[model samples]
Each structure stands twice: as C-alpha cells, then as structure tokens.
Target: MFSNWNKWSIIVFIIALLIISPILTIFYSAFLGDTSLWPHLFSTVLPRYTLNTLILMIGVGSLSLIFGISTAWVVTRYDFPGKNIFEWALLLPAAVPAYVIAYTYTDLFEYAGPVQNSLRTIFNWEGAQDYWFPNIRSMGGAILVMSSVLYPYIYLMGRSSFLRMPISFYQTGSIYGKNIFLTVALPLSRPAIIAGLALVLMETISDFGTVDYFAIETLTLGVFNVWLGMNSLSGASQISSVLFIIVVILLTLETIGRKNQRYFEKSSGQNISSIIEAEGIRRLIYSFLCFIPILLGFIIPTSVLLNFVLKGFAVINFQEIFSAMFTSLYIAIISSILVISVSILMITVSYFRSNKFQKFLIFISSCGYAFPGTILAVGVIVFVGLLDNFFKFNFNYYTGGIIILLFSYTIRFLAVGNGAIKSGVTKINPNLINVSKIMGFSFIKILRKTIIPLIYTNIFVGVTLVFVDILKELPMTLLLRPFNFETLATYVYQYASDELLEECSLAALMIVIAGIGPVILLNSAIKKTGKIRKSEPLIY
Candidate 1:
C-alpha cells in the first residue's frame, strides 16, 4: 500500500544511515583494537577516569535537581514579587554554553584575578601560600559550573509538569493539613523531574569542555587522551563504548521505573490549578533563591567578559569577530533546522506506527549525544574516509569534503532534537490520533492538522537547543571542518586551547549574544503554550 510510509521510509533510511554510520565505525575500530591494552587501561587510567566521571555526575546531578526542582516548584506554585520575570529569567542560563561560562569564570575567580588580588592587598598577604582559596579549575569547580548552566533543562521540564497539575490535589493535601508544596506538587512532578535529570546526566556524561578545562579526567576526557595521547583511535572507541554502556544502563533503569507510572490529567470537568501567593518574608526568599542561579550562571560570567572587553589590554579584531559570528550563526541555524525536522518526523512515526524495529532504531540513533562530541567526530571521520574511498573507486566521485562536516553535526546533535520531540509526543494523548482516524482523517492529515500545531513549542525547544549546541561545539568542528573554515566555536577554541582567552573574548561574547535571541524566543513560546494548555481541556 502506498502511504506516507513510502515517503517516510526514504527519509528515515537516509537519517538512519547518517546516524548509525559513525557508531558502526566506532564498533569496527573497537573490534579490531588490541585487547592487551585493556588490562593496562584497567590498572592505570581507567579507574581514575571512571571514578572522577562518576563523582562529577553525582555532584552535578544532585545540585541540578535541587536548583531545578525547587525553583520550578517555587515559581509555578507561588506568586511572589518578580515571579513573572523569574519564570523566564530562570531559563537564561540555557543560552550560555558551559565552556564559555567556564572560560569567563576562570578569568574572574583565579588567584591572580581581581577578587584574590583585592583580598591579598587588603589582608597584607605575601605570596602563593599566604592563604587558601577554592580552585575553579578542579572537580568541584567543574560540578558548580556545569550545574549552573545545565539545571535549566530540569527547571523547564519540572515547571511545565508543576503548572499542569490539577488544583484538587493541592486542596486535598491542604484538607489533610499537609504541606501542599512538598506533598502535592513534588510527588506529582517526580516523573518530569526524573526526565529532566536524565537529560542533565546525559549532558554531563557527554560534556568535554568543563572537564577538560578543569582537568577532571572524565570518560570523555579519557577518549581524547587515548585517541590523541596514545595515537589509538581503536582504544578511544573502546572507551567511548564503555561510556555508551553506562548511559544505556541508566536510561534502561529510568524506563523501567516509569513503566507502570502515568501522568494523565483526570477527565473530570473544571480542574483548574491554583497559584499560591507568598507573603513578605516568603516572597523575598523565593525571589532570592531564583536570583542565585542567574547570578552564578549568567551575571557573573557576563560581567567578567564585559570587564575584559572594557579593558584596553584585551584587544579584539572587530572585523574578524563579526565574520566568525556570521559563520557560527549560519551553521548553527542550518544544522538546527535539519535536526529538528528529522526529529519531529522520527518521533511522530515511532509513536504512531508502533513498529518495534523503527522504535529501537530511533532509540539507538539518539544515543549518539551520550558520546563525547570529539569522539563521535572521530568516528565520523573514519566513516567518512571509508565512504570517500568507496565513492572514488565506484562512482569516480568525491564527497563534498567540506559539507560532510555539517552532516557529522547532524549525526551528533540529533539527540537534542529527538529528546525534545519525543517528550512532546509523550505529553500528548494517543486518543487524539484514534479519534482523528475514526473521523476519517488520514495519518498525514492528522499529523499536519493536529500533531504539528500541538507540538510547535517542542520543535522550537529542540531548535534552540541544537542551535546553542552547534554554537558551542569545538573539538568536533575543529577535527571535521574543511581546512581554513572557522566557525566562532573553532575560532574561540584556538585561543582557548592555548589559554589565550583574552584574545578570543570578542568571539566568545558573540556566541552568547547570538544565543540570546533564540533563548528568549523559545522561553516565550514555552510559556505561551503552558498558559493556553492550562485553560483548555486535556485533549491530545
């Protein structure tokens, strides 16, 4: 039967090929690697890398949960002064890349920096050993920096869950003389919080920038160390495979825990959720809590960059920075469009078709984001090498040597798109599709008329996320881009890799500025959708 299936099959095949090729290359490399090295890895670098990665994950995970869930609960439930602004402001950190934040924070908080210098002069201290200060280039610092920017993933998801809850649950808690916030809202939002936590953990595990900057030696760091330091792509792929195993286990546990659980809104009429109003002291505390994250995530890093920009010593070539900014914007926008469109298509098909193989394929495709971008980029390089060789021999043709890097980006970033779209699909009621089908609407018609409009906010969320990810991308772009091609990320990384951050401050600042537009627009769209959903029935 000719249906959307025929059309979708062709698209899905291309996407699946692009998504799976790098992984296949990594697997082949791993299979061919010397097993003798595994024992040495276990005895030497493996334990330290695994322990540090686990510690960082636990630390960042705990902090992000606290910051994300508490702030989400406070803002969604209570009406305090500036609560309206806090709703969107809490999301600002989502715009700042963790690596850029790391660079800015290092400049601001290092011992030779203004704060320490002021302390030394005031306290009459002498040399390096005069007093103790916390190091921003350590594991603890990595956790702090990562949590500051990453918690918004949880916050956005948690708050949406909180706002959707029926008021009757809170009223029932109040009737029983229970703490409504803790007893009613938190429990109801647990699934969402976990989902957000899952995203945070995946991002943390895949993170290379903060760990590399802090010298924390995560699994991702090990992948780079093994590949570059040991000159063994096979060994690097082996390490990446281990990281991938951990992610699969974690995701499996989360899925099992959620198997029998449900979050469907009750169908009873007039189920409006009530907003709690805070008093004087409570209002001040809530507002302060909300501001703390912004202070750490955005204000501090931004202030430091601004300071350096103002300093005559921090020289910047404005024309060079502008060109880099344009390149970054162009690549980020194009890549985001591709990722989001493909994600929406995959998610819609996987959800409605109920085919086990297709579902598994999509799941495997998204796991790409769990691997370090650098490692994945290497896999892409190997795969591309093979493809180019085959093409040159068979078709007497060569790959668009430059364009393949962009394809590699699509492979790496499909997860951000798939995650957002899948979450959107999960939130929708399946009955809507059945109803549409019963009404004689074709699958494509139902998708175009019902699903697309229903999930446009999700598409934007995925777009904004992929855009920022591409903006901050470094190692992958560095290795994969055409010779002489420099996006802002690569431009900044050149100076940053050499620790000449001041020289690249303008490019870094441009990344943040470029991100600002999408961040604001996505936040607005999410909030608008939530408001509309609140008043409407719980129809799919």
Candidate 2:
C-alpha cells in the first residue's frame, strides 16, 4: 500500500513539474534583466498596449455576456418559432474561430469588398470622400468579431445552470412580485455566468490572430513585436509576465467572488419549469432576436467563405491542403489523448492521495490555461533552449517540429482536460474506492475496472473539447510548427495575413467544418449527463 502511494505521488509530482516548467522559465527570463528595451517600451508603446488590452477585454466581456445570457434565457424559458433549431444552432459559432471570422468579415466589408463597393455604386460616389464607412480592421471591429464567436461559452454554461434550477425558485420570485429573471435566475446563475465570462476574457487576452490582423496594439501583439522585431526575448518575457499577472488576478477574483455563495433547492423531485410558447408579434420578435446572433456569428461568415470558394477565388491546392488537414487531425488526436491521460492521472492523485503541497502543485499545473498562447509558446521556447544549452545540443532543429508543438499543446491545454475530469471526479462517491480497497482491489485495479467506466463520459467530453480547441488553435501552431508544417489554422493564417482571403477561404472553412462534429458531440454528451443527474438526488 505504501509503495503504491509513493509511486502515484512521484508520478503526480513529475507531471506537475513538467507542466509548470514553462511558466517558471518565463519568470526566470523576466528577472534576468538582459534587455534595455523596457524604458523605450514604457515611454512609447506599453501604455497603449495596456489600454487597448483593457478596452478589448471589457468590450468583449460585456457583449458576450449580453449575447450569451439573453439567448440562453430565451432558449431555456420561452419557446418561439424555430426554437428547436436555435437550441443547437447557437453553439455553431463555438466552432468558428475568432481569427477566421475576422478574415471573412474583412473580406465582406473592406473598401474594395462587396459591401462598400455596392454602397459606393448605389450612392454614385467615385472617390474616397464620398461617404462614411466603418473599418473592419479596428479595435471595435475586433471586439465584435471576438464576441460573436466567444459568446457560446457563456450561453452553454448559462443554459445548463438554468436547466438545472428547480421550478420552485422561479415560482417563489413570481409570488414575491419580483422580476424572475433579474431577481432569481440571474443571481442563481451568477457562478455559471461568471465562469463563462472568465473563459471569454481569457480567450480574448490570449488571442493573437484577430488583434494582429486588425493591427490592434494589444499586449499579445506587443509580445511578438518585442521578441522578433527587437531581438529581446527577455523583454518579451517581461511583458508576458505582466499579462500573466493580469490573468491570475482575474481568475482569483472569479474564485473569491463565488466564496460563501451556495445554492440548494429543497425538493429534488420537481421538474424544471416548462417553456412558454410565444404567439403573434412576440413570436416574430423572439425569432429575430435569436436569428441575429446566429446570422452574425455563423451564417454570414460561412456564407462569405462559401462565396469565395464558389467564385473560384480561393487558391485550390487539394493535395497540399489535404496533407495539412490530415496533419492537423493527427496532432489534435495525439495531443488530446496525451493531455487527457495526464489530466486523469494528476487529478486522481490530487483528489485521493495528495497532501497540501502536492495539491498546490496540481493547482499550478493548471495555470498554463491563463497564459496567452504566444506567451506560453515563448515560455516553452525558453525552457527548451535551456535544456539544449545544458546538454550542448541543438533544439532549434526541432523548433517547428511535431515534438515541440505537441508538448506546447499539452502545456497550454492541460487545464481544460483537468477541469472536465475534475468535475467528473467530484461527482464520484469516495466510499466506493474505500469499499473496493477493502475487497482487496489495488488502486490500479479499481481505477481500471471501476473509476474509468464511470468517468467515460467526462473523458470523452474533455477529449472532444481539447480536439476542437487544437484544431482551431493558431498562435502556438504559428510560433512552434515545424519549418514545412502547415495545419489548417496556419494555412488560413498565411493567406489571410496577406489579405489574400480568396486564396485561403477553403482552408478557413475547413477548420470550422472540422470543429463542428466534435462540438455537437460535446453538447450531446453534456445533455445526456445532465439527464442522468436530473433523476438522482441533488448534491453539491
């Protein structure tokens, strides 16, 4: 028994150390003081980057909340025309990457594009000063494009929380003559809403493609500019440290905000509230409200890409694009497997066998999710560079290779897998493990025969989410891919960055298409899990 305990303890320690290595490397580089660029950055661009980052976060967070919560409430509480379609359709945007949407929007709305050109022809204006037009490559444009794609995080969480709430809560609010939504639903759903908003904000802060494409001077952009342009890895690390601190604070606030807040419904036998069907003008309004987000988020961008493909504008290289697509799927599958396996082991040890110090290490292991991808990629570079230097071996040869890329993905996405698995772990009864042990079942035997079967749904969910994320992942793949490596994301980014969307529309569309299957499967798994739990007694 002691041997088994020691074995798992050492395994968990090593895993946590591996996960936290990059973060430590970044902090070490930051304090090395090798660069003299700090003063210049402070005087010129740092403040602008900070301000732009804040504005982007606030704008995206607010808009995503509004879009996600409104749609979630409508879908859960009220029935309208095409409500069934909207139920799953709202999640379609989650498959569309923010960067792809940015490119498609730019293609459709830029001066030489269809929208502006049609406007010019209609107004009979011949010059630049003919009329006013909104630029799709500005900060505001970044917010809109990002919020449209990211809002589904909030919607999924909010809808789930609403579905789980007992009907009694709403009935009580009605009896007290309070607005059920404002008084009961929103407050009860605060934790879920905040959890989703936190994810949105993290994604916004970590985004490189949209902000870079729009030429927004956010800190993420600043990281690359300082690293590659100025030849100052240390300065870049320092900037990343600042961004890292900001995300940590946000995450901490989210945790503290939920402290001492708990919800309990007295009755477990009550069903959730029935949906109210809309009629007449209300039906039309509901339909339009639901239609707007899906149109902006999924339909419009998809149609624009389809138009590009149908018009024979996109560069067709079926052999090369197909090779890249397969490569992407290969890596996503392998990395998802690796991440989920490690996440299960670590979470199991932390929950069942670890002391305070070990648990703290597990917590640190998950912090990589809070760092921007580029920053995390840079951290991996620094850490690997040190290893190469210590052993007098070259690491650059492997820089863009699959080995490094997969390692980076593991570090960046471990938190996602951990969260999904940890939630599943909590639902399990501890006494079952004790019983199995008393029956002479070893830890490994219990895990394989008992725990694994029970958590299969969560494992599938985690794998699907990580797979979708890696498929659409850009910044890390951009920085760390092998010299000739080109995933679907990097493929689209190459042409999109050059403002040659016509050349990459097919690839861009493929990324969205690839994510759709996994996302739909994930939602289905979640719904099935919810149904199973609904039949059981409520537990905190």
Candidate 3:
C-alpha cells in the first residue's frame, strides 16, 4: 500500500507542478526587480487600464446576472408558451465565441454597417452628423457582447439549482403569502448564482479579442501592450501578477461566501412541474423575456454573419478556410484528449492518494483558468524563456510549434476538464474501489475496470467542453501558434481585426457551428447528471 501510494503521490505532484509552472513563472518574473518600465506605465496608462477593467467587470457581471438569473428562474418556476424551446435555445449563445459575436455586432452596427446605412437612407440623413447612434465599440458594447454569450453560465447553474429546490419550499412560501422567487428561490440559489457570476467575471477579465478590437484599455489589453508595444516582458509579468492577484481575491471571496452559506431541503419527490404555470398575458411576457436574450445573443449575430457570408460568397476562400478549419479541429481534438487525460489522472490521485497539502496544490493549479489567456500566454513565454536560457537552447523552435500551443491550452483550460471529472468523481462510491483493492487488484486495474466505466459520461462531458473551448480560443493560440499556422479563430481574427467581417464571415461561422454540437451534448450531460443525483438515495 505504501509503495502504491508513493507512486501515485509522485505522479500527482509532477502533474500539479507542471500545471502551475507558468503561474509561478509569472510571479517569479514579477519580482525580479523590474522597475524601469513600471514608472512609465503607472504615469501613463495603468490607471486607465485598471478603471476600464473594473467598469467592464461590473457591467458584464451585473448584466449577465440579470439575463441569466431572470431567464433561469422564469424557465424553472413557470410554464410559458415556448418554455421548452427557451430552455435549450437559451444555451445556443454559449456556442458562439465572444470575439465572433463582437465582430458580428460591429459589422451590423458600425458607422457603415447595414443597420445604420438603412436608417440613413430611410431618414434621408447625411454622413458626419446624422442622428444619434450608440457606438458598438465602447465599454457599453463590450458589456453587451460579453453578457450575451456569458449569461448561459449563470443560466445553466442557476436553473439547475432552482429545479432542485424541494417543492415544499414553494408550498410554504405560498402558505405565508410571500413571493416565492424573492423569498425562497433567490436566497437558496445564491451559490449557483455566485458560481456562475464568478465564471462570467473571470472570463470577462481574461478576454482580449473583444477589448482589443474595441480598443478598450483594460488590464488584459494593457498586458499585451506592455509585452509587445514596449518589449518589456518583466513589466508585462508584473501587470499579469496584479491581474492574477485580483482573480485570487475574487475567488477567495467566493469560497468564503460559499463556506458561510448552506442550503438544505428534504426531497418532495416532485419535479419543476409542481410550480404554477403562467397563462395568457403572463405567458406572452415570459416568452418575450426569454426571447430578448436569445435574439441579442444568438439570432441577430448569426443573421449578420449569414448576411456577410451571403454577400461575400463569390470571394470566400474555401481552400484556406477549410485548411484552417481542419487545423482548428485537429488541435481541439488532440488538446482536449491530452487535457482530459491529465485532469483525470491528477484529480483521481489527489482525491484518493494525496495529503491535504497535495490537495491544496491541486486546487491552486486550476487557478490558471482565472488568469487572462493573454497573461497566461505571457507566463508560458516567460517559463519557456527561462528554460531556453538555462539549457542554452532555442525554445522558439518549440514555442513556434504545436507542442507549446497544446501546453498553453492545458494550462488555460485544465479547470474545465477537472471540474467536470471531479463532480463525477465525488458521486462515485469509494467502497467500489476498496472492494477492488481487497481482491488484490492493482490500482491501475481498479481504475480501468471500475472508476473509468463509472465516470465515462463525465469524461465525455469534459472532452466536449474542452474541445469547444479550444475551437473558439483566440488569445493563447494567436500568441503561441507556430508561424504559418492558422486555426479558424486566428483566421477569422485576421479579417475581423481589420473590420473585414465580410471576408471572414464563413470561417467565423464555422467556429460557432463546430461548438454548437458540443454545447448541446454538454448541457444534456449536465442535465442527466443532475437527474441521476436527485434520484440517488441520501446516504446521510
């Protein structure tokens, strides 16, 4: 037993260390007495970057909660005209990448866009000083674009929590003549709401493409500006360290909040059908409430992209687009497989064999998901630079290759794979493993025969999620991909960055298309997992 434990311990330790190396490199580089550029950055753009980041976070978080929680509550608590369609249709936006949405919105609302053009023609207005119009490249636009796609995180988690609420609670609220939604549902769903908000906020902070195109001077944009514009990796690392600390603080608050609050209820053996059904005007209102999000999130942007593709069909490059599509698919597949394997191995060993300290290390290793991708990419660059300097080797030879890109993806996305597998792992009976062990089965044999089969559903869920995420990934791929390498993301980014959405519309559409299937599969898996959990007998 001691030998087996040691073997697993060593493996888990190595995996955790590799996962955290880039983050550690960022911190290490930040403190290397790099003060030359700090003064310049502080005096010039740091404050603006910090302010923009805060505003973006606040705006995106607030709007996403509004969109996500409202829609989730309505769907779970009441039966509306299109409640069934809205339940799944609301999730479609999750398939669209934020950058792609940003591009489509820009294409549809910019000064020369079709909407503005039509309005001018109809109203007989002139060029420069036409009627008032909202600029789709401002901070407000960033919030709208981000919230449209990101709200699903909140919706998915919040709806699940609401659905799992014991019917007795609603009955009691009715007896007291209290508003069930405000008095019972909202308070109980706090954890899920916070969890989803945390994801949205983290993704908001990590975003680069949307902010870059909009020219919003957020911290993520500042990280890139410092790295590339000024050629100061240390300064960039310092900024990244600040960003890392900010995320750590946010996550710490979330953890502390969760620890202080707990919701418990006896099962009523009733599903969401027990909730009152909306009728007539109420039903129409509920349907419209859900429709607004779907329209802004998926339909309008998709229509715009489709329009671009239609208009540019004659000039669209099938060869290069297909080539990029194949590349994106290939990398997404390989990286998802590699990430899921590592996540399962690390999470399993941590759960079964590790000490408290080892478990803590494992927890911290997943913190990469909280860092902005551009910052994380910079960390990878710094780590690789150290390796190159120590070994006197050209690390660029590898950094410019697919291997580094995959490693970066693993670092950035390990959390997704880990979270899915860990949730599945917790539901598993430890006795099954102990029984296998008592039969003189090897640890590997136990895992293969028992654990793997039980967690196959979760493994698929994680794989699908990681694959879609990789497909839509932009910053890390843009920074680390090999010369002449073009994923669908980078391919679209080239044209989108230049505001030539018409040319890259087909490629951008393909990214969303690739993700749609996986997104649906993931949502189904989550729903199935929730149902299975609810059906299980409480051991306590």
Candidate 4:
C-alpha cells in the first residue's frame, strides 16, 4: 500500500500531518516535561475540574438538544404562525459567542440589572438580601448561556437532516400507526443529530469564555489556570490532553452513531417531507414552544447589546471599531477560503484516492475543531516556537502580517469545511466518479469539473460557517493576535471584561449582523438541498 501510493495520497497525507501538528505538539509537550506536577494537580483541582466539566457537558447537552431538536421538529413537522420567522431566527444565537451571551445575560438578570430592577420596582424590594434573585454567575448560568448560543449547531444539523428525510418513510410510519419521531424521524436523522450533538458537546467542553466568566472550573478553564496563573505549560498541556481525550470520545460516539447508516439509506428519488398543519391551540403551542429558544438565544441578548449601544454611542470610537471590523472581515474571509480549500482537497482525496490509514489521518487532522481555542493556541505557539529556532519566524510578526492567525483559524475550522463538503460528496453518485475515471479523467479534472460544481452549495455553506466561526472566535484571537490587532470578538470581550460591554456594542452587534446573511443562506441551502436530493437518490 505504501509503495503504490500516488501523488494525491502523499500530498494529502502531508497536509493532514501539517494540519494536526499543533494537536500532536500538545501531546508531545504533555509527555516531554517532568511528571512532578501531576500529583499536586490531581490532589487539588483536577477532580473538581473534571466533575464540573462533566456536569456542564451534561446540562448544556440536554438543554441544547431540547432547544435544537424541539425547535427543529416543530418547524419541520408543524406549520404555525411564526414558522417562517423561527426558521431563521432560531439560528441567530450561533452568531453570539458564548462569552458575550454570558456577559449580556448577567447584565439583564443580575441583581441591579433590568430584570431585577423591574422586579424591585414592581414588588418594592430593596437589596440582594431581601430578594433572592438567581445568580447569573453560577454553573447553572453557564449552562444556560452556553446552551443558548450553542444549540444552533444541533438545530442546523437537525433541521437539515429532518429536511433531507424522505417523505415516504413518514407516510409508511403513519400507515403503521407509528410515532413519527420515535419510529421514523429519530432513527433516520440520528446520525446527523448525534454529529450535531457531538459538535455541541465539544464546543461546551472546549469553551473558555462562558466557563471563565462564570468561574466554573472546567477542563478548559483549568488549562488557563495552570498555564497562566500557575505558570506551568506542562500542567496546561496535561489538562488539554484531557480535553483532547474527551474530543476523541465524542468523535468515536459520533462515528458509532453513524453506524447502521446503510439501513436508513433510502434509494428513492422522492425527497419531499410532509408538514402537518396544527389546528387552533396546537398551532399556538407549537409557535410558543419554538419561540422560547429564539428569545433566550438571540432576542434578549441582542436587545441588551442594542440597549448598550444606544446608551453608550457617545463614548464609543466608531473609527477604531470599524477598523477592527474590516480587519476581522479580511482575516475571516481569507482564512475561511484557505480552510475550505484544504478541506476540499483532503476530503476529496481521502474519499477517492487514499488508503484507510491515510483517510484516518485526514480525519484526525480535523480534531483541532474540538480542542479549546486557548489550548490550540498553545499548541500552535509551541509548534511554531520549535520551528522558529530553525526558520527564524514567529506567529506574531506584526499586524500587517497575521499569517499565523490564518493558519490557526484553518486548523480550528477545517472540520466545518470538511463536514460541509463531505455531506455534499457523499450525496454524489459513486458511478459518476467511476465513469469519470473510466473515461480517463484525472482526479484533479474530475474534482474541478464534477465534484466542485456539484457541491458548490456545500462549499458555500462551509465558507460561510468558517467565516462566521472565525469572526466569533475569541480565545485564539485573544492569545495569538498581535498587539494593536483586534477582531470583533476580541473587541467585545475587552469591553465586556472591563464591565463596559456597552462601549463595544456595535462590534458585538456586527458579529451578530454578519451571520444573518449566512443563516438565511443556510435556510435557503437546506431547502435547496431537499429539492436536489429528490432528483438524486441513493444508488445501492
């Protein structure tokens, strides 16, 4: 197999290694140093961090599933008043970073914040001791804020999966007097739903902003505490190793969930799904339930930020923030392009030309997405620092040259690109590729003329997702960004950190605003994919 490997296989193999080098460096650093600190770490904070992390993952996962699946189910199955609005509005929270949600909700629900202030006004309560308002800085609060922002991952995947489900399956279930959700929809969409849930769980465990803000001692926060506070890179790498293990477990579960996929694969050209029209109270109930997530995720926080902007505009330097916005757009756009380019090459090569071992390496390369951004940043810094001894180059050359940040973004977001393209590629008939090869079409020509044109929608979606993710990314930008360089995420985080979130409201709003196009485009893409799938059935 090794002797027979072609140029495409070798090239993709190298790219995969380069992509995952940072992650490999993390493991290298963990075992490279003395093992003395392990005892103290385990004795003191490790168990607590592990417990908090597990608890947070479970809480956020459950809540996000409820919000994501329920809303997705309601929209896909039931026709209601706000179905159209909810279709896209439900995805809005994805634009808001978990930390920003943490900041905004605290402002709204805290003792002196508007919610409690109004409560005090209405009930004439005096101080914190007099009234027992829920602390928005607690573990529960962290789960709530993170769930609100992260559910969109599940929602997007679930909705797309639901939309892609064949109508005949539902009709057959109806004839058998089966529960559509349990008997049909759930089974067919389980793989996609699980993939989405895995992404959500990974996002939850890898989160820094929400956990840090709430002072929750998850593994991610523990990484920072050890790295920055205790000044132990080895200990930080150790904790990051734990996070990496968790990501592996989640990815394995995702893989397991994808098993028996052949059983659910329908070889039908009819891609239509039946939407039930709810009558009277059922309609109202469906509409109300669907709106709950949008309220928690998008409406409330956006309102708070908008209020902040209205009040603090006089103090804001629009010039500075706008400059940062352009910089963010530039970097995000370029980085997303690079990530998608690599994703197309790797996934196509893996799917078509590579052996199983090489394919596994390509797959593992995307594990970067599930690592905490700070942890990934550490890996990048370490990996680059090692190279700098010979290459005489560093990640932070200057603001004008932010190549390292672009590379980091590529590593972090390559999974999104891969997932998008994979979804498209899998839908393509294998016969098409076989016939192309039979006609003496080279791999490059087939990919360019056949795969790329066919999967342009997936490519577009991948680009949009990576672009938005880069814009909303915080920890990496905060760590790896050069001095005097600011993205919208860092801008919002800076002011939010200083308890002056109002000052950077416009930037925060822009981050949310930037995603609106993508969300709408996503909605359109799902609808469009459904139509496309009708014409192209699974070839058994």
CA lDDT for candidate 1: 0.79
The candidates, ranked best first by lDDT, are 2, 3, 4, 1
Question: TM-score of model 3 relative to the true fold?
Answer: 0.94
- Model 4: per-residue Cα lDDT over 254-294, one tens digit each: 77766644334455656567678889899999889888888
Clash numbers, per candidate = 0, 2, 0, 0
Model 3 ranges with Cα > 4 A deviation = 1-5, 267-273, 393-400, 529-540
Error of 3 at 263 (Å): 1.7
Q: Give lDDT tens digits, candidate 3, residues 323-353.
A: 9999998899999999999888888888777
- Model 1 lDDT per residue over 1-540, tens place: 233355565567567877888877877777675666687888999899899989998999999998998898899878999998888888888777888888888877798888889999999998679899999898888889999999998898788777677767777898999998788878777776777787788788888767777788888889889988998777887887788777877677556535523555565564557677898799999999999999998888877777767772437777777788887888888889988888888888878763666677778887777666766876886787778777763322223634666677788888889988988998889999999999999867998999989998888788887888788887688666766677898887777778777778777777777678766865776676456444455421
Error of 2 at 39 (Å): 1.7
Residue 240 lDDT in candidate 1: 79
Q: CA lDDT of 459 in candidate 1? A: 85
Cα deviation of 367, candidate 3, in Å = 2.2
lDDT, model 3, position 363: 90
Cα-based TM-score, every candidate: 0.86, 0.93, 0.94, 0.89
Off by over 4 Å in 1: 1-11, 253-261, 264-270, 312-314, 340-356, 393-401, 417-465, 529-540
Using TM-score, rank the candidates from best to worst: 3, 2, 4, 1
Worst window of 10 by summed lDDT in candidate 3: 531-540
- lDDT tens digits by residue: candidate 2, 1-540: 223347788888997897799888998898875757677778998899999999999999999999999998888888888988888898999889999999999988888888988888898999679788989899889999999999998998888888777778888899999999999989988987887898899899999999989999899999989988888899899889889888888787667545623666555566467678887898888788888889999999999989888885545777877888998899999999999999998888888877778888888888787778988988999998888778876445654367788889999889999988998998889998889989999878988988889899999889988988898899898888877888999998888888777778888898888779866875775465346344454433
lDDT of 1 at 292: 97
Global Cα RMSD, each model: 4.4, 2.7, 2.5, 3.4
Q: What C-alpha lDDT does candidate 3 achieve relative to the native structure? A: 0.85
